[model samples]
Target: MAADITVIIPARNAAATIGAALASLVPDRSLIREILVIDDGSSDRTVAVAVECAQRHGLPMEAVSVRLDSAGAARNVGIERASGASIFFLDADDQVMPGSLSLLRAALERQSGAGLAIGASIRRTKDRPDKLKTPDGYSPDKRQNTRRYLRNELWPIAMGSALVAKWAAAHIRFPEAIHLDEDTCYWTALLARADAVTIEAPVLVYHHDEERMARRFITAPRGTFLAIARELDRLATAGVERDALQWRKAWIAQRIARQLIKHRMFADAAGMMRAVRAHKELGGSPKALQYRARIHIGRLTGIGAGASPTTHPAMPQRTLIICHDPPFPPTSGADLRNFGNAVAAAAFGPVCLASVAPWNGDAQPVDHDIHVTALTTDSQRQAASLGWRRIKGEARIPRPALTRLKTLVRDFRPDTIVVEGVALFKLLGPSRPLVRQLILDMHNVESDLADQLPRKSIWRPRFSGVRDLERRAAAICDRIWVCSTSDRERLRTLLSKPVPIDVVPNGIPRAEGIPTVLPQPAVSDGFPVILLVGHLGYEPNIDAAERLARTILPRIRARLPAAKLVLAGRSPKPPVRALAGLDGVGLVDSPDDVRPLLASAHLCVIPLAMGGGTRIKILEAMAWGIPVIASPLAVEGLDLTADEEVLLADSDEGLADMAVGLCSDRARMMRLRARAHDVVWGRFGPRAIRDAVRRGLGRNDAGS
Candidate 1:
């Protein structure tokens, strides 16, 4: 009879570890159908080690050699030669844990439809071993369909921990073009068509030695990122939701572009740019345009021209804006301002927005006019290390975020570099010499915000250190941008040296289909709603939402019993979500657009306790013709007068009183709405703001 499972081991220069890996599988020989060790152009004695281990245990084994650089390609060769019904992939440096094979086989037997069986792995360090946990609440030996498994489980789709049915393995071979994350792509492809099962027990031990760890940290080759992007594009074209896959494609293209720029791999970068332009979802994005601009500029400037005879026409000067956060989906005040500034900057010349992915999510494309690039480091350990380094007063660029930035600066060769926030000044370490001009876009006087926070706040201690760093960064930049004249003055006082400062007021795009009056309930039975729009993930917004639900809303409800509070934004943390249980408070997390919610509100409220930067939410509400009741802090940078342009309040009771007055007085509400809209259009409209940005860039360019 044919063997139950074909175990394929891809070995390359793993002589020292291959014996242990093969020996671990010997105990479960009865469960394994055949053992195939594909020596991938190894210079070491890896094949001998694997063969000896198999023979010593009286196991059925075959050995073959292939001259391929990628493990995925080697595995494809093994799959074609294997005769088993199921196939398991085991890296030469990793060992199969005891009972893992039996558990996987048992689970597969129970679920006939399951094409893949996955189990947890123990990541073994030099000093200790850490068990990688299964997704929370996952039951052992339970069968799950692909969609449900992918949606619910956070488990990695590594080859070492997966067993694929032969038919599925044959249908979905590993991607030969990419060396990085090929296993993930292969497994994703398989899971899209077949069911999968999970084994709760640890099944493999992934050894992380010094050399292997270093390899993991090295910047991935440009081809690797391009291969992943191509596969994602193919998948999207093959009926996958383009919206769901766009983020992943954006991330891959961003990384590919960065790496290409870093290594002066202009030809490859140009090819990647072309590929991104051809992609359905990414082709029209600002990120694709930025890549195109970068390639064109590089050709004209000979920035990364490696003996290429191709010539291109000279293009306008480009500006690269490096941010600490991705300015997409524009959920928060800071994100919205950054997005607006980036959009405005594009009008001056080609503008590329390079940002660090805030979370472990994929990068997203912004407006087509502004090129977008996202650098993502999916390492919790690296993040923790950076946090610790910050606590120790070290403000240098961390390696993971720096590698991509270095590549970007070298490739794009921008005329000016605009670092969006002082926190990201470390990225300037290597790019300072390459940049003709550096502009620090100070959203607010960060030091002042830190100084104003209570001593008991968790971030209080870090504020002083951060302020020192900002001061040092300010001294080096060519120019500084502040949202208000007040912030400009504050930054000048904070800085020890003189630097050019520009005041670029925050603005909003004109609203579509202007509403003459605030949206009221279509019917008489609808509740009078008070809308609070801001990203709940932000600490200040979270605090404001909690206070709104706990203190102010109750007072408003006492006066108007039918009054309702709607909290709307993206990614509300647990504490913010908990507010949904409160009476008269509704949470609308990750809404497609906050415009509809703003229209339905009788009035918008901004009861911020603490924050920096001008409030874009205030401008957005005004632009949408919604009357606003805001805290004094919310209107700090805006040229708005209390009671006329907007209702300004300080305390909880004062805010509640203003909200109650606005909802009850229709004529006063209309008056406030009209005045606020007029103020925003005249002072903070998109055309005026874009002009301000252009003028600021011109001044800096001339001065530099």
Candidate 2:
């Protein structure tokens, strides 16, 4: 008797793409006994198209439409309907390339008791006919499955475009109510059942649907939060050790925080906070709680919430803000972060901006009280292109800037040289060992933060650079100020030398010149205006916006047709601006004034995904006295009593449900708005934090 391999296709209306998917698998008919299409109750002709293609191919295919619509549910349905001994899953819009199926099947057959046989993926790009490679030259090897998948690294294994054994499904099925990472849960369960392998050969050719992919983010709102919660719950119930679960949860929470910051999902960011809080509540250690607290503070305040602020030892005449890109241009996300930091530092002293960008012109600063020093070295352009790698170059650090800094140290004889960015601080040589007091204002937790993100560039060099720079700075600097306590703790672990590390949180000088606006009636128009605000060029901000526009917003609208989202921020990229044109999403560039917008707004949100530090947007909204709903990550750092001042949700339904509740209950909204204003003002107010920074630096008065 020939052994049968079940191919499970969990599809939700792929009328335009299902035929191509089915056609691509024709060669694997010998290995695959049946192609089960779990029609997830798609509104379009996806079922009809799948049925027609199944008949045309003469393959054993069945389309099952169930009341449930999630892909995870659909896959479970197909698993129940599957008759084959071995199982493999394919997306309706994705397909297996030539030779991939055989390789996967062979790998599974070869294993003594393997439940999953993972394979690599090729990006079907029109620009590249062959496989797509990452910038670092690594291929999209899905087969290079993380050890966590088997060890339940973060959660369970990931499904969707991988192959599994039927024996695995009998013991474990995709848990109900998982749409975001259903495959992951399934794979994790399978991994727990038996051993697994990562095949080097390509098994799937996943079509790059930029639009569809972008849309999926919005539709699957809060999926990350739910997945994390479920995974943690499973780990707990499965009797996994508390320490092990805490470690995994810490890694997962950071990953979510980074993605929230990268994508800029302000509203959804609160979900990260929820996850961290939940984890801690679930018997997480005190140390784990501290880590979660730091991330939480960073997400809300855009600075260290729990940590004390950096102190200026004495009044300073000048301060230098260092970065790779020139602050003058203010074009990129990195530049904006550098520029904002530079401006903030200027409040303390005369600020000088320096960069490695190739320049022939002399020092000429623009707009703010900043002096620009640009280096026109031979490989400066190439070096600048390398991003974080520019640290490797000998001349990447502007010598002239250093000379000027040293001269300023002697002539102006400033009391403090606050290095705004870690990159700029790394370029500093031992020449200025005698500077009065050196303050390293770290914006991110360098070493471990990157490694914590999902689908990130897995490289030692990137992490090494962060670690080396931090250690060197700790050795030289008199004091350090990190945005998050998580970063402070990570630095403490990495740096053997003990330096006074003060956590001065980021502050958005409470939007000045606006009237002390009274709370207006909750805008009772059917559309619940969900607002997301940030510097949009950042990865987390962009990802959050795109995900919200494509996934979360759509779900909210489907439930309540009038629900709308205001994508408000400064310097939104073309891709970001395009989101406004999308249904239910209203995008705006840096407004002349955001007071009116805030005054009239009913709900304010922060849904950030990829970032190292706290987001000031969350604090700004709360300060404005708007009822705020946010992700756990968004509320990280601040000592927020959840479900009191602000509402928290981690999934699309959770977010929609929260938003709906806040909108429907006028009294609740008003109470939240009032409480939020008090909470933020009492905790994150500029005056209180400035005083805290002074105290941390051991100064009774900053200039005294």
CA lDDT of 157 in candidate 2?
24
Winning candidate number (lDDT): 1
CA-only RMSD, every prediction: 24.0, 24.2
Model 2 ranges with Cα > 4 A deviation: 1-399, 456-465, 514-526, 570-578, 590-593, 612-614, 702-704
For each candidate in the order shown, give its overall lDDT on alpha carbons: 0.69, 0.59
lDDT by residue (1-704, candidate 2, tens digit) is 25387788877657888898888888777777888888754547987888888789887887765434357667777777889887888888777777666777787788677766776666775555766421121122322233344234332322334577777668576765443445554554554455666666556667664433332333223443445555656744443444554645655554554444334333344455455556544326564455455556665765422112233222223455445555564433345445555544443334566555544546453323456665335453443232344552122454444444455455433345566556665444442473556676676666665554555533334444467667876787788887657667777888878898877665543323222233454455645777777777656677778877887778777777888888777778888988888887887787655666666666775555555322676766777777777778776666588999878888656776787767677788888887887666656554445444554444544322
Best by TM-score: 1
Clashes of 1: 1
- Per-model TM-score, in order, reads 0.53, 0.47
Candidate 2 yields a Cα-based lDDT of 0.59
